[model samples]
Target: MLVKELKKNGLQVELKVNIPAKDVTEKLNQSLIKISEDVEIEGFRKGKVPLDIVRQRFGQNALNETLDELVQSSTNEIIRDKKLKLAIKPKIDVKNFGEEKGLEYIMSLEVIPQFKTEDLKKVKLTKFVSEVDEDDYKKTLNTFSKVQQNFEKKDGKKVSVGDGVLLNLKPMYENEIVKEAQIENKMTIVGNKMMIPEIEEKIIGSKAGDKLNFVCKFPSNFPNKNIANKDVKVEIDILEVRVPKENTLDDNLAKSLGAKNLNDLKEKVKKQMQGELDNVSKMLIKKDLIDQLDKIHKISLPQGLVDYEFNNIWAKFNDDKSKGLIDDTDKNKNETVLKKEYKLIAERRVKVGLILAKIGEDNKIEVEESDLKKAIEEEIMRQPDAKDRIIKFYTENSQALASLKAPIFEQKVVDYILANIKIEEKKISKKELLKK
Candidate 1:
């Protein structure tokens, strides 16, 4: 057996391999011997077939088995000997194969790029710092208050902001009713931004039993492509209005939410808000680090890796299109345009992934079994009823276990880079931190 590197270019390699005819013959004969043990001829006892008879009967099968085993083993040996980290399985093409000629093949494959990571210490990044201020606390409390609000049926009352209304809505396009757009007993809250502004405004100030006719022009970026950017006539029948009762923050409210007292609830809310704000801050800093890394390092990406990622993205896009859940960015675009855009995204993702992996490798970072177990435990705690089932899943499913470990590994890598980089903490308002 002989292996020779034929070409090397930007994470891709081509190799030429040759196996000697004597080795091939030996392997073919060994396979034939194995086959003879299981063979039965009408004129002979089982497992007593002659070698030449077995070879004549199953010669092609033995040769094929030998060729497959030789190719696989030779490829594995070459990869291991060359220390190649393959991004995908190698493509093999048989160039020459005969009883007298032995075997010769070409193996082409994509590998992880061999490149040094940029100096983390030289990467400058800004970390936005924010805390849970009184206003943020008050805002969270207001959310809780809204969650606790009770609705009282208001017969004969006109619809108003903050009131829930049940209505039968029929949408018409071009003077024809859209059967799929007709909804009955649709409960919408006024000023909730659920309906278009114009339609919601028209619904308000209308009493029960009032039939309101209005036209709303759907936004061009609407999720549903059918009615997007089109003027639709809405015929609304206001069935009832429900007014919300004023909510007061008190001990009873706190107890209802599993808190001991109002003060305990407020403290929990502040802590939760602080944790959320910290996570947002961390995410911003991580993004900044990733962007910096992307700009500084110009490594060639593996095409196979990029294509794999793009296939996943494309599959999801097709699935969404089938469900009529296409996003505005892709709603009106042709498949070619969508593929072009998604391919760029896939390339960026693959590049970033490679960079992170390299960093993790350089820093000797790893995800421990304990870390995975803790993560699973935390997830199970979030849904205690499914604790047993979740445990069973993670234990049995290797893919699920990897999915759980991926984020943890990524975060650790980010943290390592963050520690090395010069991050300037810039104090910002909570609103600024929360901004998209």
Candidate 2:
């Protein structure tokens, strides 16, 4: 076989490969022998078929199969020999294949780029710190009080617009009503707008033994195909009046929430607030780190890698738009602009990933079995009756488990950098702290 480098441009390489006719004949002969041993003929004994007969029956097919296997194996062998870190699978196109000149093909692929990362110590980053105060504790206490409160049946009273009530409801659309259902004394706040906004408003002033009739028009984008953009009339039956009850935060209440006393509960609330603030600060700091990395790095991304990143970003953008999280004003913009902007993000991510990998390798940073086990246990504790499920999920998805290692690895890297860097604690107003 003869090999020639046809093209080399920006991580992309095209190569021309040619195999001798004798080599093709040898592979075809071997395949024919295998077929002859496997086939069952009427007059000939097993493994006794003549070479001429076997070649006459399946020669072309055998040659095709042999060539396919040879192309796949030889291309991979060539890539390994050349030590090319390919980003995607190589594409092969046969230019000429016959008995005389043998088989010739062209293969194209993208190889990984090489570049040195900037020194980590030279990078400057600030991690914001927000300490929980008395106000934050009081807010947490109020939230806990609401969670501990329960609803009870109220005596005879008129259900006003701002009142809460329990009721049963069944809505029907059009002349033909194929489905009917009932809600069993479900409590609904009258002015909370849980159901149809128009119907909820109409039921606000209803009293016991009073029947309210209202029609709600479903939006065009409603999920129910049959009822979408159509009018649905609902009859609501008021059962009982209900109100939210307030609870006092005492020793008993604190004990119920896994605390020793009111003081302990307050301390816990403060710690929780501090944790949330720390998480927000970390996110802000990470964003700044990426932005700075992108600004400083000057490496050019391969077209293939840029395309891959754009597809992911485009998918996420469309998903957010469908969920009403992104404005429709920017939906029809050019993808090239999006690609160019997001390419920086991709480059930063790639640079960070490579830096972390190098740090881990040079320092011999390893994720122990115990750490992975602890992480899995923490995940299991989050779900009800999900221990087996969590284990099964981790077992089935080695890639996800490997991703968990990245966070552990990155944290170690960051901790190392923070230990060596100069970070001074700064006290600021709550408003300024939150803005960070």
Candidate 3:
């Protein structure tokens, strides 16, 4: 076997490789013999086929298999010998290959760029911290208890203020049906702020399968601009109704909500709300931290890596565009312009990922088995009835299992930096912390 450098650009390498004909023949013959051992020719025992006949029957297949094995081994050998850390899998362009002529191919690959880590002490980041107030806790508890509320069918009964009604809505402007604004199967508490006063009043004595047509004016600041501040013709089809079960927030209610008692329920509500807010805080700081790191580090990103990331972004963009799901701002931009702008986003994402990986490597941070176990446990808790299926999915799919490690490893790296780097915790109100 032999190797020679064809080209060496920034983080990209092209190498020419050749394998000796003698080694190729030896490997090809062995492959042929292995295949012959598995064949049972007519009037001949297995493993008893003559070499010439086996070669005649399987020479091409054996040669192709031999070349593939040789190419992979040669590629690995050169990668190891050159000490190249690949950003992606190498591509092989075979120039010439035959059992008699030996093998020749060009291996092309992008290597990870080398750079110095910026000093942590010089990088400053702020983490916003918020304390839950009594009012906020009470609001959260009320919201969660609503989630746990039980409702029973109000069969053959008239619609009431506190009843939940399943209905379809259609509104018209200038006597034209607003197809785009029509809503189906919207569940609403009759007198809730979301329901219009005139509409709710009309539905008061209506029973199941009843229809009502009326006109109502919406507020100027209505979320759906189709009917905002306008007197529009309205139609409602009441399908069913349910009345909420009245209960005090005591031990029975707490037990129904998977809590020990009323006090425990309050504590759980506050904790859950705080946990969710803390997650939001972490997310905000993480974006800022990545921006800070990006500003400090200068990396000449490999074009292949950039292209790979861009392709993923562009593919998703195209997919969303096809589904009419792209944001309003993105909708007006031309394809070429969107591609150019998104390419920069892809560049940033790739740079951030590489930096995080490098930090984790430098600090010897790793995702432990316990981390994966806890993650899997949390997933099972989310889909309690599918515990076995969830575990089996992770167990059988190596890619899915590996995907779980990426975020965990990244968060660990970020936490390490936050702990060691220059940082300050800014105390803020819950409302301030929640601001976008």
Candidate 4:
């Protein structure tokens, strides 16, 4: 066997490999003997087929299969012997293969990037701060108030927006009944088109005991794919009309939310809002920091890593489409455009990841067991069935749980950079701070 390096460019390497014809033939003969033992002819019992008969029946296919298996097994051995850290599967092109000639092939692969990270003190970042205002407090209070609102049946009046109406609704399209149900305590909201839009529109001019036959077209882009863009007629009998009664923000309302009093609830809501805003502010700062880092320390990323990142992003893109977040019509174009855009983002991520990984290694920023457990606990809290399932998942997939350590390492590196760099805090309005 002979090995020769053809090209070495950054992470990519091309190598020419050659094996002697004698050795190749010996392996092929061995494989043929194994196949002969496994296969049986009509005239012979099992494990007694002749090599000539086996070759005649299977023909060249057996040799090809044998060579394919040998190539894979040999490739693994060669890569292990060479000590190459392949980013993706190597591309193999068979240059020569014959009875007398040796097995010759060229293998191209991308290895891990080799570069020193930029100095921590060299990267500069700015952190933004936003103060909670009256508008924030008012919005939080309004949300709590809406949750505590009460409703009662109203009589001798037309149903309008914000009024909860009880009715029996039968929806039909082309004389075929699509949906039929006795809806009690159905809200007569004008904007919520998902729930009986046409009926609710007619209910505005209808009083209690009014039987309304509404001929209206369902929204062309309705969520229910089966009935979308179809003309539907709804038969609605308004049994009761109820108005929304605003409940006073008192001790009872607070107690419903597990709070002692209105003021205590308000304070809790404000604290929660502040914490959320602080996190958002931190995210904005992190983005700015990355942008600065990209501008300063730029490097060409390995194509294989970029492709892997692109696949991850594409999976998320399809997921968003399935969730009805993105329109089906825009799926193909959106995917293509996103692929290009995310390719750039993916390359940046790879660059940043490589840099952070090297930095962690150099600085000896090790991830402790406590740190991993805390991170796993945080993930578990995000899920509804946190206890058994999350623990089981982490226990089964050790490598997957270990991936959580990367983000922690990156965060520590970022923190180290922030501490060394000159980051002047900038106070801005909520509107201004949110703007890119």
Model 1, runs deviating above 4 Å: 29-59, 98-101, 142-146, 149-248, 332-337, 378-400
The runs of at least 3 residues in candidate 4 whose Cα sits more than 4 Å from the true structure, single-residue gaps closed, are 9-12, 33-37, 43-45, 48-59, 98-100, 155-158, 168-198, 209-238, 255-268, 298-300, 303-347, 360-429
Stretches of model 2 off by over 4 angstroms after superposition: 6-10, 33-54, 98-102, 152-156, 161-186, 194-239, 251-268, 315-340, 343-430
Pairs that collide in candidate 1 are none
Q: Residue 316 of candidate 2: its Cα lDDT?
A: 87
All models: lDDT? 0.88, 0.75, 0.86, 0.77
**RMSD of model 1 against the true structure:** 7.8
Model 3 lDDT at residue 196: 62
For all candidates, the clash counts are: 0, 0, 0, 0
Specify the highest-TM-score model's number. Answer: 3
Q: Where does model 3 exceed 4 Å of error? A: 143-161, 164-246
Worst 10 residues of 4 by lDDT: 180-189
Angstrom error of the Cα, residue 241, model 3: value is 11
Model 4, 316-382: lDDT tens digits are 8778877978656555675567677778788888877777677778878778888889888888789
Per-residue C-alpha lDDT of model 1 across residues 1-436, encoded as one tens digit per residue = 8888899887888988999999889888999999999988899888899999998999999989998999989999888988989998899999988667899999999998889988777689888989888976898887877798777789989888999898898989977876655769977889878777878888889988999987889787766688888898899999989999777889988898899999999999999888998989988888888888888999988999999999999999889889999999778899789899999999989999899999999889999999998999999889999999999999999999999999999989998888776778899988888894
The C-alpha RMSD in Å for every predicted model, in order, reads 7.8, 5.1, 8.1, 6.0
> By descending TM-score, how would the candidates be arranged?
3, 2, 1, 4
Worst 10 residues of 1 by lDDT: 174-183
State the local distance difference test value for candidate 4.
0.77
